[model samples]
Target: MFRRARFAVLFGVIFLVILRYYTTTRHSILDVTEGKTSGPWREEWGHPIKTKQSKGANDTVHDESDEYVNYLRVLHRKHGFTNDVPVATRRIKAKYSKPPLKARPSLAQVKNPLFKDPLGFTRARLDSDNIWLPAHAEIPPLSLPIARTGPRPSSIDASSLLFGISTTYARLTYANNALLSDWAAWLTDGRGSSNGAGLVLTLHGATESQVKTIRDELHHLGIDVTLTASAEGETDAGGRYAQLVQQMMRQRHREPDRKWFALVDDDVFFPCMGRLLSRLQKFDTSETHYVGVPSERADWVIDHGTAITYGGAAIFMTAPMLDTSGQLLCLQYTKTSGQTGLADEEDPGVGMAWDEGLSECLARNTPDIKMDVLPGLFSPTTANAQTNIDDVQRGGGYASGALPLALHRYRNYHRFEAGKGHAVTSACGEDCFLQRFLFKDGWVLVNGYTLTRYDGGVTAEKVTVQTPKKKSGGADSKGAVKPSERLRIVDAEDVNPKERYALSWKGKKKTWRLLDARVKENGEVWQAYVNRRGGGNTVGGDMDDRRPGDIVHHAEEEKSDVDSVILLIWEGEGEK
Candidate 1:
């Protein structure tokens, strides 16, 4: 009986020791897993825990939350703040508001086949998303020649151009700054005298101090600015144009030496101002010339059966044209109001849309003005079929040779400034795509299609490269081109290094040039339709055998090995 008792006591002792060791070891393992010994305490969501500073340490916790809020407040005061701030801030706060719930492995979930393997399930979902691409691929070798920055044309002077910008007080420091910088670059360049170039800011709802501030900002940009108020008490959106016209007339009277007066939107980007000035230099500034591309509203109310110059792409008027209109154009514009057409639904005389209103005034007042419909001088969106990118790609007998001049309604001030933020960049799909077209560096990829100039000059090759297209009904098939996608250009190193392609009209040569192949920003080569001076155009003859509306291709097709479908050429002294 004593032996049995001793054995039981020994077993009990062993059980106690094992239990103690298990408890201590389990705790140690958990501590190591949590990294509590070697690192600072972290929350469940991987954020550092906020700790109170102890009296022993000299260091104190510093919170810049207030400062950040104040900085945003100041930005709001100076420039309008972003619209998504409240929603974004609240969402972030909500995400870290409480501790993340530890997900327990439920038997119900385990039973479901879809959730049987967590890793596999996640992989499947990611595959379905189609957002992720393969990290590396065998991109075909491209041989694009590096473009040379040629000498600035001594014949062309940009300072002779007068720019009248239409903007509001709020946008001066924000959206307009980008354009102001470009203009400043041209003005600061010693090639053109500041006296030859001038800037006029037509502002609405700007105070005297605000105007002064804007003036100072322009002065800092190294250009003298003339600030003018929009016609007071005018309730029409078109009233701003009246104000600008009036201001331009006054300036025309004041500065007779300034040759070209261009009315561009505050966001209008003239990538090649020197080339533009050269084109303008060909025309007589003393003659009444109305130069711009035309736009028409689908509603057929205001600009019905008439081609009106889209103001955003920019409208240029020679001094003589402005002189001929005198004050009649301004008076007519002011008399028209946004509410004029709304009052009578039955006979809504042309609504006070700036483009339509300006068209009416010019047509009625200045009959002697020469209207130059250079569709290439404006953005492609100003055309009749605005949504059709194929119209541009096909280049069916339009001014296919002339590069696009300005991108209208392409505003992306959100990157630099604050506000609701224009979606121009987003709309273009990717940075590369935007840079290729809108922010062009004088080259465009022409794949499987030829573009002919208006004068029946250049014809492209007829060859197709087998490219992969997204399956008819897939996730990636729906959206525009994916971001950061690189497109390959075939044989883009075949242009004379010294000779530039120039656009010729009526025996006069302009600096505009077109090349067959050109290099893009990412060192990729493209069978490009390159023009030294970028602008839009409408061809007159059949660009290719293919009919219009049949040239639609998927954005992903850019990755395909397409042939040199574009035939671009330079029409000048040396290029053949």
Candidate 2:
């Protein structure tokens, strides 16, 4: 009996020893403190580390960049919330009229996906400052009152000149209409959309029903826009852009007080129409003046053998220039594009962009006319030749002392399209968007862009106005000048220019990016600004981070389901 008992104890001891070994091994899987692991999951789960090899430095930088977008920052909190989320277009039951209907353009490509309820939120009133909102993605679509970006303009002066803009139905986005509505705040004089500046939208290939929807919607928002079907044979397909002046010339008799005919890309925004009107006033409208900013890309200028303007930078043609050059330029577009076989499949009737071929035609036809260069309007070329993304915009202090009248390519890299009106324009108007204001609390509010507090603190006057130095020339033309498949002269590189500016922002800085915004019936504006993450690289953003084979970085934690979001509430008119 004694021998048997002793044998049993020895067997028990060996079993315990084996169990401990397996348990310890299982625990090591969670131990990612050092990032070194045994299996083939190093590259996927491990952070890039520096090595002693020659290529190590470059590899580390490249790999680290790839990982920066690995974790997507979200707009929710982990704890203390019930599911009572607010409606995006909430209005009082009485005295609310429904706005017209237009499709909301999706900006999914530029921004990260927002994960909404299924999760809940704590109920709160939007009565004061620091109002933490429910998940922005959770807010429902418009139901009552007008969900347009801002208050409807009481008056718009359509008698001045027709402001023409062109875009395809397939390519129209939420940002497009948002910008159209925003024009009331900047371009229109007095209250609602004014007749001083009429808007003409040439929607290419859109169905009759689609055109009506957009027309009715803008009219309901108090914007009197002229909607024309720009099909191949009609005003559009590319002919409309070249012949817009001719079309507007017919209406000139009705709008006898009209001055200049301006054509801009759908993406361009006029911060203050007064500022632009002031600029145009400097030149002679009677003369054949072709005024515009040159293409920020130098290579395109070199290749074309002359300076060409990008439409997004806003192309203004004097009354005489447009009236004289209109029809001829359209014919030239057809003749030139057909000869070069540069007919675009999407824009079937037209050959190339009207800006390029039309500008070239204007030059050849009117040899005496030269481009009247507009300085300090568009953002200067990037400081470094290697980097892309130009514009005087740095952390919301737009064009500083340059006295900017317009802003372009906001959706390109900065993803500012989603934030455009909601960010600053809704509360302060376009003039206030991205403008910097320093508070006595050592905090700085860059309008709709960022709300930050520097380490030591920054002063308003100390924020000196500086501009990017122009490069010596377009991309080096050395070595055979390989013919590219497309005519793209320059494009924004993968790197975000906001990241470049982040270096100059001293101490701990937080970018309160606009997540969602809504205007109440009483004229109050509610804006949600959330911390940004996933610089367009995160993989499992909407899903739980605890999935298999996906490892969170050492700095990231699953402690909460979401990051904190900041909400700002502006009092409506007469609410005080």
Candidate 3:
């Protein structure tokens, strides 16, 4: 009996020992696995990537809860009262948004089994929602060369080109600082007067104090301004004061070397002055030239004759044309809208748009003088700001194949500020923005716009880049083709060049549009491209109804977190 009892106790002890050992081992394994994950672990442990040479990628990890909070910090540092705010108030990131502002907060990581390798931060239900967040701005490689922005390289006299813009004091004070910054970037170096091009500002109803405040801002920005105000008008949008030619002729007369008076709207953007001078130097400055780009809408163009220079596209009038522009003093634009495509039979105009009236008056005087449509100048009238990435990727009005001469309706059609996007020019020089480069990893970089891993593994060898259906040029000195409702611009669905390139592959492609760009003290341009669809989180469809504090059991049930960012750090100067 005693021996049996001892045997039973020993057996029981053995079983207990074995059970304890198994439990400890299992927990240790789990502890190690959990330690390998957790959000911040990605910084220490590099994840393995697997992608096909041509068209396949697989990634199953991302961050769901945390996002890099660099936007607010940047806003504070750039535009906020930096001098008044305490040092603690300057940053949204803990100790990260320091002087010179590198602006890259670390991306936290989570698990997502649905995505491929190249789409590190992309959500699975991309059809439902997507977002673009600011990533990192590392100096980009200097392997490829694009045109740079600097002083005039050629003997072309850029001083002959004088630019003008008309805006109200309220409009000029509120939203035009960034735009005026863009102007300064193109026309002047940091101290202004880099290219010797002049800028004339016609504030519609600015008070003396308002004008003084703006002059202070412009002087600090390095743009020497030829500031003036319009005569008392009925309305700021349009009126008898819209007669700008007489006032502009006075400015034109002030400069003996003035060859062209480029009267542009407040939104017109010149990416590179050298390119503008080159395009203009092609034409005879002595001739009576009425130069502009037609509106994108065929119906609008038909309503306003194609011969009329669209104001936003800029009215580039040569010296002789400026001389004649003064004669149209009779064709004054007014508050009461006038008839389209006519100028009161060459008398004081009532309802016509200033640009249209000018065309009517000029056509009446010199019947042979034609409207010279500037090549590569785009005026996207029917575009939305949110779809700028898709529009450019597919080469809709946002053609990246060629560097633009001037882009009108900047953030109106495009999402980015012209100044920020053009910052790369300081390092890469002119013509670098929106330039394309394909990489071995099946990714492509559209300089200053997007870095993309296209669908169907579109590499340099496989991809065929085609622009949107070429917009028909303006009709000859005659009127435009009968207004057609059928004329639709190239961007129909979400446009990514890959979609247009691979007709066979119908799957989705991914893009990381530029979210933040800034110039460092060392002259490097740091650009961060995030995988968010900007404008809004959802791309094509509407969002689902949701309650607060809900825990999702499956990955597919939750919105994708912005845990991925790609960086393109450009060296301050490219290798010559």
Residue 35 lDDT, candidate 1, scale 0-100: 19
Off by over 4 Å in 3: 1-142, 145-157, 190-194, 235-242, 294-312, 332-350, 378-395, 459-506, 533-559
Candidate 1, poorest ten consecutive residues by summed lDDT? 87-96
TM-score of each: 0.42, 0.55, 0.59
Best model per lDDT: 3
Give lDDT tens digits, candidate 1, residues 104-169: 000000111110111110111111212111111221121111122211222324566777776776
Model 2: per-residue lDDT, tens digit, 221-339?
55557788765444333465665555676766677677777777766666545445655677777787776543223213324212234334467777787777765633333433333
lDDT of 3 by residue, 1-576 (tens): 999999999999999999986664211111111111111100111232222222113322123111222322332232211112111100101011113211111111112221233223322211111222211222122245332333322222467778777776776554435555666666665334446677777776677888888777777666657787664454433333244565667877778787888776676677766656766676788887777643232203433322223433467888888777666644454445532335444464444555655655666776676666553433232222223324443334443334565666545444445565676776665556665555444555666665555456542223433233323653323222221222222221211222221212223455555545655556656565544321121221333222232111112212223323444556665554
Error of 2 at 258 (Å): 0.9
CA shift of 14, model 1, Å: 40
Clashes of each: 22, 23, 28
Candidate 2: misplaced stretches above 4 Å? 1-159, 173-192, 232-237, 293-313, 327-350, 375-403, 418-430, 439-442, 453-508, 518-524, 532-561, 570-576
The whole-model lDDT of each prediction reads 0.35, 0.42, 0.46
Model 2 worst lDDT run, 10 consecutive residues: 104-113
